[model samples]
Target: MFWKDKYEVGVELIDNQHKELFNRVEDFLKVIRSTTLGEKKAQKVNETLEFMKAYVVEHFRDEEEYQLKIGYPDYEKHKQIHDNMVSFVLEVSEEYEKSGYNDALIQKFAGRLLTWLINHVAAEDQKIADYAAKREGI
Candidate 1:
């Protein structure tokens, strides 16, 4: 939900991308938590969703490139994680549209996104950083 200093992997570009991701996700959560629920709020939610779709793809590409550059041992596994997330986002976006932008669906998506992002950054990503540190002396 929030970016912490401890999350830094000591790779400047990747760390900055992670921070940007955290910031965007935090803002998305804040918008979802807002009490105003109507055309205005729905517009904001749609905007955030759009941003997520594009930004997530870009971030994942950069992360994957970083992994490839470093010859990360678990690069395949990490890429699978990214692929799964992309698929989930696409599926959710379709469902959101089919449901006429239902508030409940959006809320569920937000909750899942929050948990997923935290776990990915705090746990999964840390593994990559640990390996890079140990193998490459980063």
Candidate 2:
């Protein structure tokens, strides 16, 4: 439900993937915010984290490919942003596991994830659409 029409980048594939990411994150938030705790909560959080580990990489790869296809001038910069986010996610996942799936750690991670997702989709990704529109005269 955090996803909005304005966040779309006008690329069907990317838009769909973005929506999936939003949905996943929203589900993640719900799981973490629930009254459940201990093993049940950790199990749900781990599942969502694992899914994000794979899906985020896949989505970034696809998005980068699209950027290359369009010859987006800021492809390198965009990729760096993606790379940084991927690193952060991985790092946090590791920390969470090492901490025995600490609740506070995940709560912090969820907040950061939400902020990053919104900013990336709403602002950063919009630049891509704007460039494509200008390039293709859309």
18-84: candidate 2 lDDT, tens digit per residue: 9999999998888888885557778877887898899999999999999899989999999999999
Candidate 1: tens digits of C-alpha lDDT, residues 8-110: 8878887898888788778877877777756666776677778778988998898889889878888999999999988888888888777766878888888
Candidate 1 stretches with Cα past 4 Å from truth are none
lDDT of each: 0.83, 0.90
TM per candidate comes to 0.90, 0.94
lDDT of 2: 0.90
Look at candidate 2 and give me any clashing residue pairs: none
Model 2 stretches astray by more than 4 angstroms: none
TM-score winner: 2
